[model samples]
Target: MQHSVMEEGTAYEPPTYDETFPVLPESASSSSGRLNIFSINNNLQLGRITITQMFRVPGEERKFDHSDKFGERESIRTCKTIMKETNTIIEIATSKDQSLTFLITGKQNQVLEAKRRILTTFQTQASKQISIPKDHHRWILGKQGQRLKDLEKTTATKINVPSVQDQSDTITITGTKEGIEKAEHEIRVISDEQI
Candidate 1:
């Protein structure tokens, strides 16, 4: 992992347990997965963050007669409600070109949850069903699902390629219609490339 970043021209090295991190006592560790993860990531920064995301509403969904760009300020209302519920900070701005900008600041999980909710609720999302051999699911998911995460972030879609246990054949994709098609095509491409 360290060597990979070095190859990418990162000036400083990522922290390792040798110097900055602490080793936990056997007695202090427990069975809870989340706790174990928190301990491991303690060396990683957990500071608050502020991010801005901007995008224009699709023309078909635009309501020109309305005040806001998309004519659906419901997205704002939903986000505000989620912020209040999660105790996160979210500020929204509009642009002349029918764009909506989101200013979000909060803890790591808080920001992620708020942003996900905003995107899923506000955007034009759809679900598509694809049947791939259950055994091939892992190829699409990749190791620890890093591949699927990358695909989602790249295509702005969510892909559910079934687990080994369920033996389910149907993979459900939920996102923009375009994103679904992109993800589906990429999944097939990945499967083909692997072969």
Candidate 2:
């Protein structure tokens, strides 16, 4: 067989076969012609997405007490668990108004599931204030505060009535919207009965 050798300084040219075969672009010229498949796989694997959402909890932004800190810790733990379970990243920020902003990043389904679980675990609570005569405070309190405790338990709410020395007629109820409504109605009824 005859051999051909090219000079070192000369540009090498590839020999072409039949003209009927078309030349492929650099991306599609691989031996397996799987460049498009690889690109698609890259897109699927590297396509990370993020969503930002804000949730408002009704009430003034007050200083956190011990109970509040405990609740906050539980909420943080829940978020961390959700992130691990769904393979998502969650960033939570608190606004001056006590609203929470959550930034979740991951695949589309993972992010969505994380958001749903977080929102479900932390339902927004609202606080409402209603006024009754200071004289009616004892009626709401009942004997040794048993009535107040029962009301709180039944309504799934926290009811804060003004102290004897405070002289304020306002009572604060905090809970879910429905719970607050029910507590407010019962409190009003108790006060009206004393009339």
Candidate 3:
């Protein structure tokens, strides 16, 4: 048998079988199961977890009264903001009965913080309805509802003005007792100006 010889002062290198076996594609080599295991391990190391929570919105504060033009409800917007601020993920689903279910994912501390903020924001609150002339609704709404939005922001309340089609003069304000009182005062001031 002939013996193979390596050149002196040269390091030995292993032979590669380039064509013997087909190289696996990146995706094939990293199977989803293995990646999932890795992800689980990483999350364990990071103390990440997912939790589900359900909250019942008061009947008086439904989306019809608090949604923006895009139809994103106020609670949804608030959750999204909380998610960003707390470095968490929040998924909101509205039930047929108007309850909100939140799927929150993050580290334990972050998830708890998000939950606390959401609970505080959506806690039991007061609602007040005031009557104004239908004609003055336009003035209270201002151009594209800017005035109404400003009043809500300033008073920390949600104000729902009846749509023109509804033919209702009732305006709904929902928030803390102080907020409702402030908003009521403001709405009355605006309506009185229309006289």
Candidate number with greatest TM-score: 1
Question: What is the lDDT of every predicted structure here?
Answer: 0.68, 0.72, 0.70
Tens-digit per-residue lDDT, 15-87, candidate 3: 6654554456865655443333333344454344555444344433543535423225665577778989989
Distance from true location, Cα of 34 in model 1, Å: 44
Clashing pairs counted in every model: 0, 0, 0
Tens digit of lDDT per residue, candidate 1, span 26-142? Answer: 734652423433345556665455454444445343333335444355655776698997667877666666556666677755665666566676565779999877767888888
**Full-model lDDT, candidate 1:** 0.68
Which one is best on lDDT?
2
Candidate 3 has which clashing residue pairs, if any? none
TM-score pick, better of 1 and 3: 1
Query: Model 2, residue 54: what's the lDDT?
Result: 39
- Candidate 1: regions farther than 4 A off: 1-42, 46-51, 62-76, 85-87, 95-99, 107-109, 141-156, 162-169, 185-193
Ranking by TM-score: 1, 3, 2
> Over the full model, what C-alpha lDDT does candidate 3 score relative to the true structure?
0.70
